[model samples]
Target chain A: MSSLEELAQRVAEGDLEAFGGIYESLLDPLYRYFYWNLSSREEAEDLTEEAFLRCLLHIGRFDARKASFRSWAFRIAHNLLVDHIRRGKGLRKEELDANREADEPPLGETVEEEAEKRALRQALEELPSSQRQVLVMKYFSGMSNAEVARALGKSEGAVNALRHRALRKLGTILESRGWR
Target chain B: MSGRKSKEIKAALAEDLLRRVESPKAPQRLQVYGLQRILARAAYETRTVERRWFRNPALWRRAVVLPLTALLLLAAGTSGVYAASMDAPPGSALYGCKIFFERARVALTVSRSSDARLEMEFCERRLRELQGLPESGEYRAWERWSREYRRNLEGVDSLLDALPAEESAGLAARFQAQLEEHHALMEGLLKITPAPYLPYLQQASRECMERLQRLRHRHGMEEEERGQPRGPREEEGTTPVGDTGSEVQDGAEESGPCFPSPSYPQAELEDLAPYGEDTAPSGMAWTSDAEDNWGSSPKESNGVMGEGSGHEGKGSANHYWK
Candidate 1:
């Protein structure tokens, strides 16, 4: 079986240190997945912590035969996002713009390149929620199309269509902004 | 608008930009929030088979609820005795409560002036109680009250000494004026005072006089003694000079065994024995409000002969000296 599946089995048996291995493996994907979906970094981090807490609390119930641990974790993060949205806190573009200011340019990236990335972020915020979920899970969460579809409770064709449509919309947006 | 830019946007969306955005992992920032705590709790919880006694309501009632209930009950139970003790006289059961509460008041009072003022009130209270004692068969009660009264005086003395000259002046004048009135009341009591009790009353009166003069000298106030005789013997025409009243001048003031004075009315005698206890109703109490009210308007008190403090309680007491 996979290393994550082995860790999940040990976690079920109360091998405490083995749970750390699973946490380290899944922590980044869950954080980036939430960050791209939410307006603020703090919200992303809180939800990320919440996802892990739920995971550890119910680790004994995980069935590796049915799904990979990463897929299960992504499912939890997605349900939280859905619940967060249902609670009347969807992405607010104004806050998204405010939080985007903290993304300082990396070394060797030109000012023009940074501006292009900034424009891309704004355009990404304008996409529909379902398409953005598929896009964020596919690219940022390291999930295969099948895993992404399973986490979102959609078919593989639906996940693919949502991804392609999101990318095409992003491309059209960049073109409209006179992006090079 | 341009064909080349459109192609670049397409490529960036497909591969170039998504790769860069996917790798934006803030591992350090994530550590600051809560991932480490999750890891630690995961380890700690699974490592120990926690019995989770905190979840038991029975344990919570035993650990928290009972102690709080007991504390609240104790406070409510003692409040009655605490209230009654406020005016308890020297030999009464609640008298100790009076002294204890007075000391606690001084300790709790934050301002030095207010603290000194409180002690001054105690001094006055004790002096009035001492003066109210009967001349006959109350030597033990008299001595007990006299000692406590002197101690209260000493407390006020040190506190006054520590006060600024400006503040001490007004306070000493008021204190002297209050004592002057008490001296006058003592004179009224002296008209009926018997012979054997003369020396103790004389000596006590002399000590009070000395303290008053020291206060006047210290504060630069004019002597306002108003010609009140020092004690029963010294008051003119009340008792004969060469009679038993002469015992004070003959040095019996120091070591005399005082007897009860004659002609004391029974009502006044009971009132004197245990302060204003004779007039106070059984459920009536002295309160901090009396001290506070007297402090705010010391001039309003009708002096030692005035009604004893009327207070807010189930019953009211009106002290009488006539």
Candidate 2:
């Protein structure tokens, strides 16, 4: 069994210590996925924390045959993202991301590299929500097509199509912006 | 050339997107606080369920077996039943579950603005639940829900006060508008909601209206200082900007964050308190119930008061919390 599955089994069987293991594993991916989707890191963290709260509360209902704990947790995050957008945080949040950038530049990155990343964030924000979710899961969260599909409740083929479409549209946005 | 550009952009996009969320300390911080709270909550939930499970065989079927079947069914279908929680009212067996999710949300949300938003949502939800209570049969429920309603507004008040003047402006604008609507809604609810709820209803409506009035007064003062045009109300030349404050502002509470904000100073609230009454006027009064509703009494609520901790015994908004 996968580590997440093992952890879920442990948690389900009442070893609360496993909560830390599973939480550490999922935190980075889930936090990154949410941080990119929302404008403020604080808001992202709140939603991320909320998603885990739900996961812990509902761990018993989890079925490994249906989805991995990672994807199931991602599904919870996805629903929250949808609810957030529905509450009018969607398009309006993009307006805020126009100003905020990465917390710290990684080692040896250039000034222009930072600007390009900023432009790319703006571009990513413009992509449709489904496409963005697929990309964030596949690339940022390092989930497989099947895992992304399971998280979003879409077929793997549909997930692939979204990734393709997201990439095509992202390229168009970057080309038009010409941020060299 | 276009194809090459597309490839480079896509590659850069993927790489840069992955690099953006790199906060190292935040997760550890979250882990420290999140685990303890989640476990404490888990323990509390287990106890509540166990306590009830042993106490009532009838509730056992209702709480355990039925929910187990529902959880199985929901494992595939709508996951919302558990997440948003069943709309279990105050005394329902699943009500503890409902409150557990709310506490987790509030406990997990450390950001001031996020907390304000969540409190706004909760206060609004509490009001809606109260409205739908159908009759005066549930006085305890009414008291519990209304107390939460008051606590939420106080939470919002404290959060907004804590925000820097610049940061609070936009959010306060939105909140002032919302509180206005809530004030109106509560006024309407007071008239229609049944009799047994009169004192609580009267207190709620008055509190709602007074809070709206104070925020509006502060908001107006800020606009004036910024040298912007007066609000539509003042522009209409009808409401004497501080008419309410001038007549009825509470004297002892001026030191509270509620009144002396942005443009107005604490002395100004004192100046406005023409009457000798030490108590706040209407919605401005923070009662013994000012402490929030997360199973914490007013005294215990001060534990997380953070910056507002100084105002503890001084009858700042914390005075209203019980």
TM-score (chain A only) for the predictions, listed in order? 0.89, 0.90
Give lDDT tens digits, candidate 2, residues B76-143: 55455455455777545565676667767888987888887888888778777767763435445555
* Stretches > 4 Å off in candidate 2: A91-113, B1-28, B44-322
Best by DockQ: 1
DockQ for the candidates, in order = 0.18, 0.12
lDDT of 1 by residue, B166-191 (tens): 77777877776765655555555555
**Which residue pairs in candidate 1 collide?**
B132-B272, B135-B260, B135-B261, B136-B260, B136-B261
lDDT of the candidates, in the order given: 0.63, 0.66
Docking class of 1: incorrect
Q: Pick the candidate with the highest lDDT.
A: 2
Model 2 C-alpha lDDT versus the unseen true structure: 0.66
Tens-digit lDDT string for candidate 1 (A1-180): 349989988888978678778777888889888878887777888888889987987888889888878888888889998999789675786667777677555567777667656675677777888887887888778899989988888899989888877787777776677764
Window of ten residues with lowest summed lDDT in model 1 chain A:
A98-107
